[model samples]
Target: MTRPETLQASSKPNYSSPDILRQFYQRLFPFRPLFQWLNHGPTPQPDFQNREFAFVLPGGAYIRYQSFLSADLFKKQCVQMTPERFEIGPQYSINPRDRKQLRKASSFRPVMKELVFDIDMTDYDSIRTCCSKAAICNKCWHFIIMAIKVVDTALREDFGFQHILWVYSGRRGAHAWISDKRAREMDDAKRKALAGYLVLAMSGEQGKKISIKRPLHPHVDRSLKVLNPYFQDEVLAEQDPWQSAEQAERLIRLLPDKDLTAALQKKWDSMPGRSSNQKWADIDAVAEAGHLSTLSAKQLVDVKQDIRLEYTYPRLDAEVSKKLNHLLKSPFVIHPGTGRVCVPIDTRHLDSFDPLGVPTVTALLQEIDEWESKSGNMSDEEKAKVQDWQKTSLKPYVEYFRGYVAGLLKEESKGKRSREEVAIEGLNGMEF
Candidate 1:
């Protein structure tokens, strides 16, 4: 994939050369930590060798099915190529080494994959008026936060899976990798089922898009609960859909009582320059004055649903969650347009995770330049410290990912029997 062209000349830096990127990959990239994360858990041998990796070169050329026998090998290849961006395949191929044989095989084997979800801002273009395409601001970012919470809660509580890895998309989206054993073991059918279940809004042409029933499913209900605050603050107050006459008319037409709709329209028209929130409040006051009593329970529910359909419901690229072979951008790869590293997100501090705050390659190179200029010669300890990613803002996120993977390893070890124990059991079973 090509880097986005939305980045203006003044906003982007100039250190996008192959040399600077190669130096970053060789000297400063935390390969060891990344390897530990990918090699998580207690199998006889971790599945990194079986996993498929792909790279996107500077001119948008793509490479796929590239596997490494070990972390050292993977590190070596990355250091050698210094790719513009890279992606990790969701599915593990049965034979990563013999790519041609695997492709030609009649019955393919895709043993496991972390259930991945992709949420892009462009999906919300229908609702959001502030930004479009790859552009984003704080107002639009609230949608991402809502998406994470809704999906995270459903996966953890409803599906009974844990160990989710959330990562920034390096551009205009976010990805969630549910690395729990059960999630990874899910077949294509199960993955499709989950994707279908999560989809409330269907995709199609403009007018025929969504169809939701009354008495929302507990999953959607729970998601709406998570979405309530963001909708009120970001969409209703800030976006002010009611500002558009067409949008306001549509909302008014949804009301069950014709008299109430007319009243709301009149009230809305009188307040020519009022804030969207204020206009909405005036309409609510009219409803409360005995006008709302005319509507049935179903109508009231539909009104609330209409509001959600316009603002809070999760807009997902269903194919991302449904497919096993889909490749997602690897974390820590630099986004060529913005030059920012695709960092891992800590959901506990989701509010604090800002895409703008991520370190760009240019910024890191500048830091290195300053460091080299100040100290012509350095001690071993100083050299090590300079190489450590801990000197940057990305340190805490990497450490958080390391701790999560460490927990998975600890869990895996608990179920494992040592070689000595197995040997003793074998000996005891034999007759003299």
Candidate 2:
């Protein structure tokens, strides 16, 4: 497979500088759609004001507990500061004016918040070998795709959540925002339970990394079903883990019987010239033979399942999902390292969503430059296209987001009418 283009080309202008970043935010950021997204639905408009906003500056300086009275105000502040990163908190506080009073008051309750999940590529360091840090290549991108499939499936099928939003983390990961009413109302403990249920691996310097008991639960089984295709095609064929002797030996150690391990090791030693794919084929044959002869069915199943889990299971920042107060990098903010917009991912066509393909701040500016260079006498259609985010690759993602918000608003309106009808019936009964 061909490798995707890198973001660090010589021709690309640096947008990390404060001046260019400020201009980009002022001239190009889609404030209208963002306002609609945050203030969605037919309920009280003050809900958007209670949501906390945070910013991360150029030199690693942090700002928190910031609130905006309106989307216009939020947009103005963003254009003025042009923060390198912007974050939104899951929990909404009662009062935006007095933070201390809001926290201290017993009457004030920490109410609704979207159940969020953060999946960072750095967490898969042990499994991937191509690139590390913020760098990503096509070979390593399968992990992200697998992560999305697993989580998306579980969230929709198991938890019965609709209106899920998936956003590409401008740098090396992705985030999921579940806006279903039931999900938003869940407390911290319930969120913690959900996070725990999704995670099967433990993190530490020592001991086994992944542990699952016998009689594997259906969730794990379903995840494996979702993960197996990518594991076989991408991890096995493309990654070629058996190329290194250390890695090969690790695979051999997972075999159930000593004789089968010895057989595989001898075969491996004899075939020093074999390709990685051929070596894997030999190991697979031996494992299959052992299953028929000495190994029990469970042993063979466990070995294969362990291999899949080791390579492709979702590695989550459990804290992000568990804590209500934790803030996540907001969508549409430019990542300092990559300069790409934190655009939403339309999971309907998830396979086509590429991080490398996201429009960078520099690129958007260049697009504007090109547009301005043209003759001033353009048609109405062309003018409209050039003015908004339609000129950039962010159009589709923003449209998808707008559609989701519209759906929520429709539901909210329906609920309001139902409540009004019930109230009218109660008044009539009182008169009688």
lDDT of all predictions, in order shown? 0.73, 0.76
Candidate 2 lDDT over 170-221, as tens digits, reads 8789999887778887888999999999987743322243456767888889
TM-score of 2: 0.89
User: Which 10-residue span in candidate 2 carries the lowest summed lDDT?
Assistant: 202-211
Which residue pairs in candidate 2 collide?
Answer: none
lDDT of 1 by residue, 142-257 (tens): 78888888888999999987788898987788999887777878888889999998877543323332446767788877777778788789888766766776667656654557
Candidate 1 has what TM-score?
Answer: 0.86
Candidate with top lDDT is: 2
Residue-pair clashes per candidate, as listed? 0, 0
TM-score of each: 0.86, 0.89
